[model samples]
Target: AQSVTQPDIHITVSEGASLELRCNYSYGATPYLFWYVQSPGQGLQLLLKYFSGDTLVQGIKGFEAEFKRSQSSFNLRKPSVHWSDAAEYFCAFFTGGGNKLTFGTGTQLKVEL
Candidate 1:
């Protein structure tokens, strides 16, 4: 069975500080990995994705993640976060067959001034 897990249920970081969100996955083969951010009452926006190329991938809003196959991890990191960045982030994976997607429970980020 393939699954994605986000250890943190919630995270609070001061505005303009660095942020890191932990993500781990269990899959038999290399899967399509993605990070999405969703603002309150809105649809999720794709932050980045790792298909089959480089281990490091960058995305919108100054976000980047490194995929470590051995570690089974794809963690998101931001050097400096903004208050607007506060939202729910979900780590998702695709099985690469039917366009099906599995999402983590999600991590809510709170930006403190």
Candidate 2:
């Protein structure tokens, strides 16, 4: 079965520091990858997505992810961490022509002052 994997359960970073959230996936056919963020009490919002064309896709809020087919990974990166960025980040993907996005456990990001 196709699935998304986020190895890190939680991550912490000081304000102004760079951040990276790891994501890996397994799929039978072409995969549509996505990154979403959920604030404390808000709904999940799409950060970025990679379907085709470029290997690296840019997202909102100064975020970007690179699709590495050889490694089956789509890691999210932010140049600098901010307190407002603190949220639960989910890595998701749709495989084998599915409408629903299969999401990983999620990686909680904590930012310090």
Instruction: State which candidate has the highest lDDT.
Output: 1
Candidate 2 C-alpha error for residue 75, in Å = 0.2
lDDT of 1 by residue, 1-113 (tens): 78999999999999999999999999898988999999999999999999988999999999999999999999999999999999999999997583898999999999999
Model 1 scores worst on lDDT over the 10 consecutive residues at 93-102
Q: What TM-score would candidate 2 get against the native?
A: 0.96
How high is each candidate's TM-score? 0.97, 0.96
65 in model 1: Cα distance from truth in Å? Answer: 0.5
Residues 31-108, candidate 2: write the lDDT tens digits.
Answer: 999999999989999999999989899999999999999999999999998899999999999864666889999999
The whole-model C-alpha lDDT of candidate 1 against the native structure comes to 0.95
